[model samples]
Target: MTDTSKNETNATGAPVTDEAPNTASADVEALQARVAQLEKEVAEYKDQWLRAVADYKNVKRRTDQERADLIRGASAGLILKLLPVVDDLERAMNSVTPEVYASQWYSGFKLIPQKLQTVLDSEGVTPIAAVGADFDPNFHEAVIYEAAGEGQGGKVVAELQKGYMQRERVLRPAMVKVGQE
Candidate 1:
């Protein structure tokens, strides 16, 4: 005769008891907790990745701006070297006799300074007007101080060498003669 008080045997042949239900519920609660934790971690990782992408974009923009600024100022040195040649050409043109000035060769020679000036203009180089303007130490370098004539006190009487500005910045100061009171 079979004993009725014996525990029930499952398909696996293991004796099942009331403790099986409690253990299965505990496992389900633990799995839910683990899923929540994994979700939280994934959110944090996503936020960090987004921040990294933003930082990279900012750095790239800054680098591009710096490169453009560098390119704009790169021609400054060469232009500085060419300034003396321009000065010489202007002096020669100014000293020309009336007979020589009327010659055909003088007309062709005059084009050289015009071309150089065009190049300077395209590069944003502009000559500073010093003569007759009030002398400022920033844009004018005083080479001589002479007695003021009429209303010329504290003004630039003459510019020995022309000053130039590249863009908004002074590339070279004018060598000038100032009028003194």
Candidate 2:
């Protein structure tokens, strides 16, 4: 006897229907869409992580720079306080008479200033060239405006006090006598 049902039998006598294949294809399509959505979310999360890492590196670099700047400022302050002592030593050495200059004590005393100057030089402290240069308020403080001499108009004729620089920054401005027309 022949079966009258729409279902057909496979080799193992199991009933097969066209609707079964369509249902399985629909499930596969849903699963593929879910996978695509997950991939997009993962990409977004990865981009956020990279940006966070870059921000952390920038903050570290800025903090390190600030620390170095603070150290330089503190050292500059200490050097400012020592400049007067250097001037005093220079004055004392200059006033010594020939007789006193020839003494053993005078020679030893002169070495003190030389040693102090060496230390300052090693720390990047340098004297500003004020004499014979054009008068500028940034590096020279005009203590007296003197009458111009030959070819000395608007120039620094003499430095009453020495000026110093720490690296590129001005530690002190020179006290100068400026010549005017």
Q: Pick the candidate with the highest TM-score.
A: 2
The TM-score of predicted model 2 comes to 0.83
RMSD in angstroms between candidate 2 and the native structure over all alpha carbons: 3.3
Cα lDDT tens digits for candidate 1, 8-71: 8889998777678899999999999999999999999999999999999999999999998888
Off by over 4 Å in 1: 1-25, 149-151
Each prediction's total of clashing residue pairs, residues at least 3 apart in sequence or on different chains, is 0, 0
lDDT by candidate, in order shown: 0.92, 0.91
RMSD values for the candidates in order, in angstroms, are 3.4, 3.3
**Candidate 2 residue-wise lDDT at 46:** 93
> Which residue runs does candidate 2 get wrong by more than 4 Å?
1-23
